[model samples]
Target: MTLSRDKAIIGAMEILSELIIIALLSIAGGVIAAMLPFAFPPAVISLFLLLLLLFLGIIKEDGLSSSSSFFLKYMAMFFVPSGVEIIEYADLLSSSWFHIILISAISMLITFFAAAKAVEITERLMQRRKAA
Candidate 1:
């Protein structure tokens, strides 16, 4: 059997509305984080809240498809600031390239292992839930 993908035809208003909703949620997340004494990154909290909203069907994927696509398409552009920072630190980075590479590779491996284990655990739990 052949699989077909459904392409969502998104309009400008839909993109705008979705962006507004996301912005409001992010602002709310930031406010909540600020009110707490703990050190929590507002952006991560907002993203987690967004994921929860999507999972709960409070925010439909279609509603944010256009905006998400727009952001994803220009995701590389988001790294410009980081690129500039790296350039500014070129002297330090060049001197410690070996150490940087080693740490990066180690961190990457750790992250990969963590993500794989998480997925495996989640799948096992899902299977158990289904079996029950």
Candidate 2:
């Protein structure tokens, strides 16, 4: 069964969860850095902490709402801004890098298959556990 429309969107406004927590952590780190007379960007500080949390397996995916996951799923598009730089220096990806492109394509295909298999295995395990 899927979540109802209202329930799915309820967490969207309650920033008390993931997004707000990351923002607060970043802000606190920024303040600490400023107080210590260190020279570090606030955004970078927050992102660093977020990565640390991720590494320690703190933030979870299951607790995230469908709407938040939707945004997170598409957020990779935000990298398009930096991706535009590839066109700014298009010559860097010319015919000389054809092998690189071919290898990258193959690697991406492999990664996709691997991730799909892993998810399938995980689902099977969960199903078996639930049945038991």
Candidate 3:
């Protein structure tokens, strides 16, 4: 009983630490965004900072592995608030549904085409490297 309790305590502590790290990084991004003159989203800055830290080896993937996995596993839940807000705008959506659907479909097709072209280019470069 004591051993299991200790293990549970340790696991909780690790989860807390992971949350703290993520919060701190987000706060750091907000601070940087505030210091800048122009308007910019703090979340975007935060993501960039996180990527920079990972690339510079300041933060290792393994350290955030568990928390990252947990977040990704339920990421759809994070969008629940936005989905709710869309419900609030049901009138606007209903009136412009056709336009919205058309734009969304066109944008999706463009995005898909761009992604496919990028993959093709990358594969061609990789093949050339292998040949040489």
Models 1 onward score TM values of: 0.68, 0.39, 0.80
Model 3, position 49: C-alpha lDDT score: 89
Task: Encode model 3's per-residue lDDT on 59-129: one tens digit a residue.
Answer: 88887888999999999999999888998899999999999999999999999999999999999999999
Give the local distance difference test score of model 3: 0.93
Per residue, candidate 2 scores C-alpha lDDT tens digits across 35-73 of 766687877776777667767778654544553676688
Q: Order the numbered candidates by TM-score, best leading.
A: 3, 1, 2
lDDT, ranked from best to worst? 3, 1, 2
Residue 16, candidate 3: C-alpha displacement in angstroms:
0.9
Error of 2 at 102 (Å): 1.0
Q: How far is 69's C-alpha from truth in model 1 (Å)?
A: 1.4
Better of 2 and 3 by lDDT: 3
Candidate lDDT (C-alpha), each: 0.87, 0.75, 0.93
For model 1, name the residue pairs that clash. Answer: none
TM-score winner among the candidates? Answer: 3
Error of 1 at 70 (Å): 1.5
TM-score of candidate 2 on Cα atoms, chains taken together: 0.39
Worst-scoring 10-residue span by lDDT in model 1:
1-10
